[model samples]
Target: MTDLTIRARIREASNATFLADLDGEAVVYKPVEGERPLWDFPDGTLAGREVAAFLVSEAFGWSVVPPTWLGDGPFGPGMVQRWQDIDPEQDAVDIVAPDVAEAPDSGWLPVLEAIDEHEQPVTLVHEDTEQLRRMAVFDTVVNNADRKGGHVLAMPDGHRYGVDHGLTFHVEHKLRTVLWGWIGEPLTPDELEGVDRVSEALRGDLGRALEEHLTPQEIDTLGARCAALRAVGIFPPPPGHGPAVPWPLF
Candidate 1:
């Protein structure tokens, strides 16, 4: 692995994150030593989860996550992912006033309604696009527990990329996310095919690759999630026991 030179710290991130120069390209580096222990997730495993998510995204062939790998950085071993240059004018997911959400040409699907600061009504919505729908399916297969709106990067050419995947791949059901707009909708053929590809890959090389990052049980559960999606052929409904979406939606 090439040495990553620290450029700056990403203070907004919950875990210790940094912007670093890997060769001549910019990348986001989250060192294992900087990980905060979570009661549910094993300590120092968040970096591995990020790498695992990237591998699964690649297997799906959707580019939902940027290129990511586990490598040694200035701080120590960590997850390094290519940095995305997002478009400021576009938002794949957003919070908008009810009237904007109600517009027929708005091209957004309302997921939730709530009062904003100043006691105003607002709707949590995301664009009705195939890219986002693919991401939703990817999240489901990985059992992502923290898919915040801010995590979806809207690129200049309109490609959507997701980040912050530390909370994922639990042995149990823990799918909490903001991309519930397609709940109960039948899966498109392309989406189903992607799931099928992942399911098949899990039985061979992909499964072996993930063993470096995930436990045997977690990997098994991941395969089961893929099978369940293939069986249902629909976007899954949110969990009945826990909160359906992550807080601070944006």
Candidate 2:
């Protein structure tokens, strides 16, 4: 774990999470407190996600959202991550409730339906589809096995960024996400430009740069994914197995 200074414990919840102003800034914290590890979630396999955070952060020039290892979580060693306000009170838009997907009461299964029910304001100025594509590229680059809708966090500013990278850098081709709005749509010229840049960058120096964060198999998969996207373009058909999207994406 990277070195850190604990400023304060923000709150105590089921996850025993807190907010630390590490190095003089506010960051979200989810500390391990008990033996009940967050073993319920399918992926987001902790250690692997930290590496995924590194790779994705480097791939896109966006702020990387990762958990900081403060100590043991409720079950074992825990981590604190960057905190982002999904909805700011100053804004007229209620990023929660009406817009945000309701939590599944029965369990996590209804999360998908709730996510589908939540309405995302499609304005002329903001284009969510474009944002999803960039994230899709990042997902492919990291070989994120679980690219669920809950992972995709829409910021107040309109940037659609993804989180939860524990199940990343897999050797297999497991790039599942909920942003299939552009499945049949062609990659826009601007979007293609970014893809082209990444494609060229992944060949030599950039690929080498990511070497430390990714394993041999992971790196090879990244290169292959890039080639595949270039040849077939970004959109592809859905998977054959379980829910391709994350459950209860709010």
Candidate 3:
């Protein structure tokens, strides 16, 4: 890999994230040294988790996650992913006024209704598309703990990519996201096949690849999650014990 030249710090990110130029191409780097220790996750593991998520995405062959890998950066060893050119006019997920959300051809499905800072009612919604639906399924397989609207990148060609996957692959049922519009809906035949691919790969090369990033227990639980999803064959409901969506939905 080409040496990364730091361009700017992404200050809005919770961890030390940087915009870098890799051989004239832009990329995002999240160094392990800058990761804030989480109460539940072990220190220095977040970078590995990011790579692990990418690996799982590849196993599913959905291109849901961008090309990601571990590399040395200005800050040190970290997770590095190719930057995506997002479309400013597109949003795979969004928050809209209730009236707009209720339009017959809005092309969005409501996930949650809430009050904004102006004391106005708004609805959390996502595009009703097979692309976004695949992402929702991908999130479930990875046990994504935070799937904020901003993490979803909408490309000009209509492809959707998911980023910020550090808080994922937990053994616990910590699934949380704004992509709950398909709750209880049966998985399409293609979706089921995707899940089956992950499950089969887990028992072979994919599981072995993940050992570099996740613990044996975490990998096992990931496989279990895949098997369960395949057996149930539906988008799961939000967990009862915790907030179903991440704070600051975007």
Candidate 4:
């Protein structure tokens, strides 16, 4: 922990998060000791879930999530992830009023609409990019319950990185996200191949690695989700039972 020094407190987070200089490299650290109790996820498990998400992203070869792991920090044991310096001028997801007229064309997908501060209509939109599609697939596999607009980071090199995965990989079907644009679209050859690779990995090493951080039941569900996605060969919409989108999207 002495190797990592807190550079700043990430006040936007619900739990205590800090930007730490780990041996001169910047990393976002989420301390498990600072976690707030959740009704669903077991106590002190969110940090593990964040690392699990990173593992899944790496195993699937989607590379949607940044490198992350469980580690010791100034606040104690928690998740530490590589800090992605996103382009401030651009966001992969946004909320734009319908009358804004100047919104970008072609690559944008309006996932849902809501009322703005003035009680006017606004639409929640995300870019229709291959990177985002891979992210959506990864979210389905991990059953990410909190994929807000802010979680999708647009990097300087044009790669999109997904962060804030503390609410993921529950045994239940809890895949709420802002990335519903590709629902009902047929999966590409590369996407199908990615699913196959993840399914196989889950049977062996991936499953074993996840066991350290997740319950057996949750790991089983991850395998099941991968198999189902491979069988369908298409991006499926949210199931009828639960809410499909996260609130306070940004």
lDDT of 2 by residue, 1-250 (tens): 3444455564433334455555566665554342134533343345435544554455555443443333433234555566666643222111233223334441111112322234543211112445666666666666665665455666777665566565666665566565544555566666566556666767766677656455666667766766776677656656566556543322
Error of 4 at 18 (Å): 0.5
Model 3 lDDT, full chain set: 0.93
Q: Model 1 Cα displacement at 141 (Å)? A: 0.5
TM-score of every candidate: 0.98, 0.62, 0.98, 0.95
lDDT of 1 by residue, 1-250 (tens): 5568999999999999999998899999999999999999973399999999999998999999999999998889999999999999999999899999999899999999999888999999999999999999999999999999999999999899999999999998899889999999999999999999999999998999999999999999999999999999999898689899997687
Give the Å error, residue 138, model 4: 0.4
Q: Please give the ranking of all candidate structures by TM-score, highest first, separated by commas.
A: 1, 3, 4, 2
CA-lDDT, candidates in order: 0.94, 0.52, 0.93, 0.87
lDDT of 1: 0.94
What residue runs in model 1 are displaced by over 4 Å at the alpha carbon? Answer: none
Which regions of candidate 2 are displaced past 4 Å? Answer: 1-18, 29-54, 61-81, 88-127, 248-250
Candidates ranked by lDDT: 1, 3, 4, 2
Worst 10 residues of 1 by lDDT: 36-45
